[model samples]
Target chain A: MTRPTRPQSAPAEAATSATPVLELRGIRKSFGSNVVLDGIDLAVQAGEVVVLVGPSGCGKSTLLRCAIGLEQIDGGEVLLDGSVVSGAQRDQQARTRMGMVFQSYDLFPNMTVLDNVTLAPTLVRNADKAQAEERARALLARVGLAEKADAWPNTLSGGQQQRVAICRALAMDPEVLLLDEVTAALDPEMVHEVLQVVLELADEGLTMLIVTHEMSFARAIADRVVMLDGGVVVEEGGPDFFEHPQTERARAFLRTFEFHRVGR
Target chain B: MGAEFLFQGATIQRLLAGLGVTLRISLISVALSVPLGVVMGVLFTRKNRVLRAVLRVYLDFIRVMPQLVLLFLVFFGSASSLGLNFSGEVASIIVFTAWGAAELGDLVRAALEAIPQSQYDGAFALGLTSKQTFARVILPQALRSLLPPSVNLVTRIIKTTSLCMLIGVVEVVRVGQQIIDFNRFDYPMGALWTYATLALLYFVICWPLSLLSRWLEKRSSR
Candidate 1:
């Protein structure tokens, strides 16, 4: 099976000089007797977009959660700009540097869209309310949601909610954005709108680590693609890795998506 | 003659005074219980096993024992055994506040638990502190689900204040009984009229609360 050729960013070769913006070194995590991640290492450089792709339950989402300090790792360490930000050292202040978006948009239902976006900036950064709202409005306008400033979250469509969620995370001015299946909960028609917002963010050179099942999207946006199976990295490469996966597990995983890609 | 006795100016004043006492106990208990119940409810959601266990015992004890028994224990037993003298009205207040707080605490716990975990995750992801998350995010949403049932609790407390009569507190029911005994010889149907007035008074107070609860339930569900 062959994938359609598309414009792709050059690999993150330019970022090898300084410490990575986000790094997970020999990380291990388990729930009860079940080991979800085992000694995995990954790095996302400043302005790099890394997409983690694997079969369900392969720890892709868990790894993203660990990077943002939402989940405590059982072994190894997570680092942000060469400083440790995991385990006992993980604090709310350190976590603000990394933004995360969940599968469920999870917008605070009680607040309006503008409030949702400005909450972290005003509360955590101590930014002026006017400054925070101005930035939030600009972010919302960028996503074509400026009119929804006073709208409650439940009043918006799934795609619009996800877009507002992206704005909320971006408003924090995070050093690295961690997206855990952000498009997973949207309807088929809605997924494109949400993904389009993300694609634009990629073009603006936001550093991101995304876990997604959208192979075509992964190929289009990822500077690096890391394939995982059974909690370990099986193959890591550039966009062309989809056509030339170096491992049997990665090959098999990519093959499963071919059935969906046949007529397209 | 029975109707005339029931509507006498002095008898009407006595009934009003008795109702005032009932409202004072019920409203005071509710005011104290709602806030204390909210704190206990939040504690119930925490992961502290010892704290949870202790609260659980308090909640369960209140649930299993009757409020009348609690009133008696406080009013009768405290004066003799604990050597702490409390008036009947004071005893009734203490017992009802304890009962209301426990019942309302359970209601609050259910409301808090009904909120999805994703709400907390969303708040924490934005770097809001735990206290901020509770005050700003969790409490506002919980209050929506909490209001209807809480209004229902208010009505229950108001009705149950009638039980204070058993503890020698002259609430509305006690006032009605006194009127009946005094007019027994002069008015043949005085007992019936006085009891009917007492029932009407309770219905007037509680009916509006039930309506408010239902209205709130409808709004929150939306």
Candidate 2:
């Protein structure tokens, strides 16, 4: 079920062999008159964690959704590996290469935590149930939810559920994971555990495209940070982007998220 | 109207015969309609404008028309005018199915919708096709919320089947009327006793449904 992936660019193929695991070129999405994403371009390279930071309603979540094929993009193209995968027809199987965790924990309320993690592999990949369960238990134990495997999602604390959400996405064995504000709903006290799990993933070389309001976490984890404003990429750079923003738009955006104290 | 009259061997036999007919129609319609309603419910959740509009009209049509009017329309009006051949029992079954389907569809839709948007987004983000998302994520949650209301609807459908007496279907109420008609002079209060007995029978059937509904409500909430 794995198809050969095409190469993205000359340099990417030549020296680095660092083709973007997921790429979006001029992706555009509009909800009728309200254009959520207006011609955005971004890419997450292999083993890179690219955090998208912006004010609420700047379309960070929409861009993430469009990339995952949850929401259709009306303009531009999305590339998984190097193949075009945008518009009405998307390569659904290729999407398994990149997993996403939502702002809401979004764990299936009916299923046990273990079932939620193992679901996609068994159902979509047609993996053997025992194998999926074994992997699920290992992943759950990593998130400190091994005891909560058979527990309902609602029974777990917000932090545990959010960790389970990460585990669920990881169960797909995705090359690049998309995380859209996975900790936004957690209580302030509970946010650190979720971020800690993400930090560990980044350290382990899992490529990720993340949209988050946690500027400090973004600053620490992001290999590159892209600042979005009103459906457009206003600025992007290294870890220093938060402290020494290049654009007036980026500086203005970061001003509002004053909680981030990076590269002082 | 003494308690002794209710247990008379002859009265017991007639009521049992009527109960059999009532159950036959109710069971058939409930069995057919619940599955049909589930399909309609899933269809109702689709984003297609045409599907939504068509379903809205059907649900409204079924809900707004009185069962008696619908029965007459199907049996007396449409059956002969359209060259359809069916007995009163078939007509009753058709009518109750329509009623049950409409009610059950709305309940199923509501139950499905009650599932948080997060579950849907989670499924979509995982790149699950619509079918896998529903079967894996949405259905179990919907089923939990679906049962209580569905049981209540079945109870109402069973009760509503009594309307079939007007069309001469020989269900429980019709049998009660027959008992009253034949014993009108000799039994004095025969009509009163017969009607009360029929009501008691309905109560016996429906009260359990109410209890089941309450039980499900508690379980789901917990």
- Cα RMSD, each candidate: 2.8, 5.3
Question: Model 2 Cα displacement at A135 (Å)?
Answer: 0.9
Clashing pairs in 2: none
Chain B TM-score, candidates in order: 0.97, 0.93
Per-residue alpha-carbon lDDT of model 1 for B129-148, expressed as tens digits?
88888888899999999999
Q: Using Cα atoms with residue i matched to residue i, what is each candidate's TM-score against the true structure?
A: 0.94, 0.90
**What is the alpha-carbon lDDT of model 1 when measured against the actual structure?**
0.90
Residues A1-264, candidate 1, lDDT per residue (tens digit)?
A: 122332444445556677889989999999999999999999888878899999999999999888877788999999999989896657889889999999999999888999999998888889999999999999999999999999999989999999999999999989999999999999999988888888888888788999999888888888889988898998999888988998888888889887665577
lDDT to native, each model: 0.90, 0.85
Q: Lowest-lDDT window of 10 residues in candidate 1 chain A?
A: A1-10
Residue lDDT tens for model 2, A77-149:
9887888877587666877777899888888888889999999999889999999999999999998888999
DockQ of candidate 1 relative to the true structure: 0.80
What digit string (tens of lDDT, one per residue) describes model 2 on residues B1-222? Answer: 344555655877888799889999999999999899999998898899999899999999998999999999999887679988678899999999988988888888898888888788888767688789988789988998899888988898888888888888898888888877867766778778888888899999999999999999998876
TM-score of 2: 0.90
